[model samples]
Target: MKKRLIGALLALTFCVPATAGDITPRLSPTPEQAQAAYLSAMFLSRYHYTVKPLDDALSEQIFERYLKALDPEHLFLTQADIDAFADTRKQLDDAILQGRLSIPFALFLRYEERTAERLGYARSLLAQNFDFSQNEHYPLDRSKAAWLKDDAEARDLWRKRVKNDWLRLRLAGKDAAAIRETLDKRYTRLLANSQKSKSDDVFQTFMNAYAGAIEPHTSYLGRGSAESFDIAMRLSLVGIGAVLQERDEYITIRELSPGGPAIRSGKLAVGDRIVAVGQGDGAPLTDVVGTRVEEVVKLIRGTKDTPVVLDILPADAGPDGRHTLITLIRDKIRMEEQAAKKSVLPAGDGRRIGVITLPTFYEDFEGRRRGDKDYRSASRDVARLIDELKQDKVDGLILDLRNNGGGSLREAVDLTGLFIDTGPVVQQRRADGKINVESDSKAGAAWDGPMAVMINRGSASASEILAAALQDHGRALIVGEPSFGKGTVQSLINLDQVARSDTPKLGELKVTVAQFFRVNGGTTQLKGVTPDIRFPSAFEGDEFGETRFDNALPWRQIDPATYRPANEIRAILPELTSRHATRANQDKAFANLREDVAELIKLKEKRNLSLQEAERKREKDSREARLRTRAEADGTAGPGDDGLQSSERSLSAELAAEKAFKARKDVLLEETARIVGDEVSLLAGSKRLAVGN
Candidate 1:
């Protein structure tokens, strides 16, 4: 198998010839560091999917990506400043090979000055008053916006930015003094964070830029981030088990740990902006905006069983969205907590339906390697639940993979084997240009009653594998939005291990080592698996997928493996599609969802966001009113309102979570159960024998 992996050989790529008198860096790498870089370059060039040349083109891209990473919002560096680094850009290849970090350090020093200047301007706005009535706009999502021509243009942008910040807070029920205080505190904290950037941090940032240009998954992990990554993997740290990253002045929750307190709470969600954090009930939720992530993280961390209240602004809400306070008990991640959870859904004819929400494709590799008799994995847990559900005589099953970012490749194969009698589960393409068919040679099906798999944009990697395999085998109907397209495999290589370094730590590199393909030879790279019954996606844009990266590995195909369809889903897709549309039209929640999705799309398309307080307030009010009306009809409260018909107490995190997981009102799940019911009907309607009969 190892021999099948092909390495691409580049004639001119071994090393760049070192020249004398290179600009000395402020924080230079040692000879050992230089060797690590050379080794990494060679490893990536040979193994990376693109095998892009190490010439001037890639060098230019590395510089561009580096700059973008540091100042993505283009608030700091100007167009003129970028142009000044053009010569430095071309010399990156040589710099990287020769262990010269001077160019990147020079750029970073300029970035530091730029940040100080921007922060000073922001702080200056606190002393001045602005008219809330002015019809102004702010370019909120300026990721693609051109850099400022000069400092004057930047100041103009920053002025509106200041007003926009003021308006958002004001709309959120703060007064002028409070707003100024918040902005002042935020800027001061930000300035401090800027000052704290170490040379290692800058080096990691620069290296990641180079790595990311190779592929989206490839990244350089600094010592701090690497340590954090290790902690997350071990699941030992106690806190709200949510992975977060800084995005445009907010710490956004990326993925929730499957069995963590966060996921079980079900109140916290991906893309939720954590604007504030506080201790157990009664504490004021202090705003965390513009604060260093570590400071925010420290505030959230606490002892086990202790509650933390997070004031979050959900991603889908308006810019001045209602802050939803969610409380969660801090606890270590337990396997049982995160394992496949089962609940019964109602079928139309007084029958029960089984729904298994698998948060991730988990596996205890160490236990398995030690040959433990009772090892935990997604397949094992799911197989047990299937037995219990079958005992309950469920008419059908729905496997919920929503927000499942995926894990454990072995589990994806093992889990897929539970459904099919015998077939290939997935195909893996290595650097050698050969495809490895990972197969299931077993001969018996598991539960096999009418089944449906539910997924969304967050479903990725192993999640995509299982969904694509089931879909390919005609075993289960898939539901929800297109899955997150992250098919490539990442291998973490510690750079310090690459070249022995005792004095200076070299951190680690997460390199995209391989690409995953469906058993049918289709790659789930950028174009994730299309659900059989499509649902209106909450993530209306491409911001959440592998395709969002500028240099993501392109989707490719291989020869179809020898296989046959196990069932006839294609024949019933028309019937399912028709029924789904009809139900969506009649279902009020579904209708509301569709409208929400449309609004989100419009928001995504807008190049500029309104800074005018009245306009912003109008949009926010309209959205809230619509939601409140819907909530009233359902006999529940909406945003900023308690769930009870009448109550003195505010919403607790536990109650809020229970309110959310009320399955009947979960339009997505409701429709999923209905779809599974349809699949059950299809099974009954067909002449073919029911699976596992």
Candidate 2:
């Protein structure tokens, strides 16, 4: 997840505390903070895989990153403010090495001042009536927009912004008085949150900026952030199963955990911005814009079986789009909920196709360590499922890994063992140029019939490894969109453990120390695995993978590992591709999928929104209607299904849910299955012809 430039004001004086109406002290770096900086510099320079020098060039990148992190939308800081800190760009290396951070802290304080100014101006604008009839458009995504030259330019932008905010509420059926009250409270809270920023926040923000400038995946986690990471790793977070990151003053959903309420509800999506949170049906919504991600998490977390209402700005909806209120019950997402499951679809000529949807490549590390015979592991589960499917007389299989953001690396290699006899699966290259090959030595195939591995943009890391290995060995036909290119591996280094100082606490630095490669030699870094049979993708390559990151590692190649092809799947590609294309064209569900993908692409490309009230309302209503129509056609719940929903289920309920999912019209899955069915028939024909010859 991309870290947000969170936290507001910095405190300068260490011993002083703020009283009511007193000027809050500016944030400054302490001796401990300086020690951390020096240590971080040493570790990153010496140990990071990329080995980038902490020189003037890197210092400049860090400077730019920090500035952008502070004001991503260019709403708070002006060009003057940037110019004032121009000289510090190249000098940051010296500052970091010497443990001096006054300039960085000063810049953060300037941002806080600007935020207060902008919010005050916005509040003042709420008192007056907006000319909503004007046809001017507001830029929705201003991350790449030019910085404001002066205060006048900033005010003009803020004026349009205030009008846009008001217009959105008015179109959402809120009264003028209610809109006014909400805006007032929102602005007040935003200002207060800015003032409430602590020294740790500033240190974290700057350190992350430094780390991110070197590599996109690297980050410095504070104590609280570290604890959250542990909670997420343990899957103990009792909340709406949504992974959020603060960006551009909004708490945006980055990913959804499988079997989580956020995903099960099907209302929330990646890139959606959560603007407000309500405790229950009767509680008032607390505004979350410009708030810290930690605080937002606290607001969303609740006891199991309790309801949480979220006011969200839909990802596909442009800036002027109406807010959607979705209610979901909090619950713990168990490993079983994301385990591999099997289904059988009958094909022509008694060719039954088995589909196994693997959410993530997971394993019970502790259970395995304890020598449990029946320990929960993706490979074991999949092997068992394959056995069951074989007994059901299935001729082919489809490994559905659409949204599996990979988990266990060992499981990936072990899972590969189920297909190939024995060979190297993947190779890892460390910072010192040492390459280690991870192989599956165990022999014998689990179910080596005609098979396909399905992946999408969200399929990453270990997913890419497994898919690439299969593709390399000709073991399975790869299908669907390109995988998420995330070949680099990161390890968290606790600063306190390695620090020379006796300081009680420091932070943790997650650094990319190695990169993994496919058995075929190429790394899935910037270039993910390309499918043998491609499908229409709603997400563009540059918008949704490693390529989206500014400083991600580049794809590289090495000497291919010695491994024999498992089958001659590539020889029959032309026939399979032709048949799949014909079937996709004739399939109504596939056509609908293409149309929906095209619509989503268009929506994602929308950069501006009509500020005119009537025009905006028409657009929002039309979009909503189109979505509702699509949902109905796809056999999903429409806007009318916004009541409280829970995904927690009993054994019977789980079975029912699985049945319903299989019955649902998933165009992509259906098409993939048809492609596999075509392959099965084609291969069978080849075998018959061979026998006759």
Index of the highest-lDDT prediction: 2
Cand. 1 Cα-lDDT: 0.77
Tens digits of per-residue lDDT, candidate 1, 1-693, equal: 132331232232235334322344344444444555565676676666668767788899999899999999888899999988888878887777676767887888889989999999999989999997777789868778889889999999999988877777777787878778878877776787787676667778888888888887888776667766654443246787887766556787866887888889878887788998999899888898876677788788768899999989997876798889898999965534566899998968776789999987777655678998976678888999999998888988899999899888888998988888788889989878878888887778786668899999999989999999889888889999998888898777666554444643657778787898987888999999989888987573278887787667788988877778766777888998998899899987787788878988888788897877778878888877887887777744445522112111222443465466553357788788988888788778564322321
Clashing pairs in 1: 5-432, 6-431, 6-432, 259-338
Where does model 1 exceed 4 Å of error?
Answer: 1-35, 223-338, 372-376, 500-504, 538-542, 635-637, 640-665, 685-693
> Against the true structure, what is each candidate's TM-score?
0.78, 0.74
Taken over the whole model, the C-alpha lDDT of each candidate is 0.77, 0.80
Instruction: Give the CA lDDT, 0 to 100, for residue 119 in model 1.
Output: 91
Give RMSD (Å) of candidate 1 vs. truth.
8.7
Across 140-160, the per-residue lDDT of candidate 2 in tens digits comes to 888888889999999999999
TM-score, prediction 1 = 0.78
Model 2 TM-score, 2 decimals: 0.74
What's the true lDDT of residue 516 in model 1? 88
Report lDDT (Cα) of residue 384, candidate 2: 96
